[model samples]
Target: MKIPFSPPYINEAVIQEVNSALESGWITTGPKVKRLEELVCKYTLAPNTLCVNSATSGLMLALKWYGIGEGDEVIIPAYTYAATALAVIHVGATPVMVDVEKDFNIATHEIEKVITKKTKAIIPVDIAGWPCNYSDIYAIINKKKELFIPKHENQEKLGRVLVISDSAHSIGATYKSEYLGKITDITVFSFHAVKNVTTAEGGAVCINLPEPFKNQDEYNYLRCFSLNGQTKDAFTKSKAGDWRYDIIYPGLKMNMPDILAAIGVAQLPEYFEKTLQNRVEIYEYYHTFFKTKSWAILPPYKSDDKTSSCHLYALRIKDISESERDAIIDKISKEGVAVNVHFQPLPMLSLFKEMGFDIDNYPVAYNNYKSEISLPIYPQLTKNELEYIVSTVTNAVESSL
Candidate 1:
């Protein structure tokens, strides 16, 4: 009974959609891509949505759109995957690292402490599909509005710190009974293979800017930005006598093609109807199995105001060193269960270390990382597989202890 971690939910419907895309001949940034964007807007209730090749690119685009650049600072959680920090770095901005709360979200007080005149944006990550406290974060941003010094047009228009949600793990999750995308200024969702909704390798940027900043206008500009600044996509150019186009700004080649978008198109309906429900059930099962164990620190998946997408069951073991946790993971693997760590804090990684970041500075992030094990929580896992996973993890933890 070999159990793999987080496989994509690819049914016959997904294959059929891909087949239809292949047969259409207009496979690159065509109708399917537009359709996927529409479906995302309809589901998330965002004012506008733009599909991109990856969430990294979406973050970069958001940063660039806000005019975040050299000498500017962007606040991010040290506990997140490197992509969050890397996006800031790619835009030539400094990533101001902050410690996370016990629930694996950026500390709002920490955010307020580090904010300066140079702070341009705050990228709060929804670790393991659990949303951060947006109401508090927004209040903090508004409280610090006088300190903001806008460097560009968009920055001036926004008049405060931008909140670009690193929502790669939290598309279907809700914050305060509202979907994540609409709750923030801008939310980026990943459709990577292991995500709850996959497009093999794709992402979407949802825009929900306030008055005086038209979301449709922003969406249009971002669409062009994703396509190397071309005024028209290949699909539009393919139409009779529509070859004429213009290069507006030097942009990135990050647009999603129809073929990949097809996967998301097929997956969205099933995701809302069944896939997310299955993941919630699996999450509950894991919680029920581990609640009695004193060593078990269960990941938060549901609350009165928030409901997780159940992306990762990031269970933590108590009183274990980092080395001990690694040993437990190895033991579980040997027993034919595939488990993983959510992340090593940025300061623990080689890149941030050379940049003069110390893991000790982010004690909470390091503490969270040391004993964490991400269990499989996907739509495809069977009941037998779920039981096997818990039993295997329990044996490994007790033995390691």
Candidate 2:
């Protein structure tokens, strides 16, 4: 009766795609990568999409392109994983960590309070595939628009604060009846192993900008940025009499190889309606099962304005300390049912602490962290396995108490 948490849904179709890619001699950034980018554009309805090696790289590129740098400040929720804050730090910007709402999203009021003239961007993380309140975030940015200072051309072109969505867990999510890529200035999605849709080790950056700034230009620039800022990709260079290329920007090597892109193309065709439907059903079942328990504090998966991708079932244990929550997780593990915690807020982590942040300042983030335990909700779980998970989790929780 052993159950693992959040394994990627790999089937024969994914393997076939990988096999086809292996057979193809052009394995690095070729037709398959181009096709995946096109599929991403069609699926998300974003004007342009760029596939990168990982979500961290996508977020970093977005920050760099938006002109976030030394002396500039990027606001982020303290409740998110370290990658959210790390991107800001790696770009040499000061990360102003804000408290999160009870729903594990950055507080709009907190965002406003921390915003100053140095504020260049705000990275709002969809902690568990649930879309944050972008409408309210947009409103806050509009109110504070007067204070934002542009340090570079790209930033000035937008003429306002940039909203870079850390949508690592929320690829297929919807906000205000529109896809996630449409809500933010730039949205980064992860295709890590545990994600709802995986590409082994890959990510995509969806650019959505207004009239003054062109998404096509941004996409072209990002393509270069992902490939060591090369003037031509490997595919183009392979053409006869086209071995010439140039380095345009001081970009890192982060382009997605064709093999990984092949997997993405296979997994993406029926993602929204077919693949994601399984996760939604599993999430709903957990919600229904947990509601009858007094100790269960359910995660917000569905609301009037948004529906999550059901990436993580981050259930909280009401009135419990962090130790108690850990004890419950240990009990479940010993019983062969694997569970996890979505995150420990950035301030509590060693890196942010050394950087002069205090977890006490982010009371809301710590409160949310102390009692949270993420349950399994992948697309591959059978009915019998799910039932066993439910019973084992219930029994383990009671035993721990």
Q: Which parts of model 2 are misplaced by more than 4 Å?
A: none
Give candidates' CA RMSD values in order: 0.7, 1.0
lDDT for residue 95 in candidate 2, whole number 0-100: 95
lDDT of 2 by residue, 1-401 (tens): 78988777878888999899999888999899889889988988988999999899999999999878999999999998788888888999999999999999999889989889999999999989999999999999999889978879988889899999999999899999988887899999998878877789999999999988889998999999889989999999999999999997998899999999888888988687698898899999999999999989999988898999888999898898999888888888987888989799998888989999999998989989999989988888999988988888899787776
Name the lDDT of candidate 2: 0.90
Clashing residue pairs in all predictions, respectively, total 0, 0
> How big is the positional error of residue 296 in model 1, measured in Å on the Cα after superposition?
0.5
Candidate 2 matches the true fold with a TM-score of: 0.98
User: TM-score: which candidate is best?
Assistant: 1
lDDT, model 1: 0.95
How does model 1 score by TM-score?
0.99
Alpha-carbon TM-score of each model against the true structure: 0.99, 0.98
Identify the leading candidate in terms of lDDT.
Answer: 1
Name model 1 segments beyond 4 Å from true: none
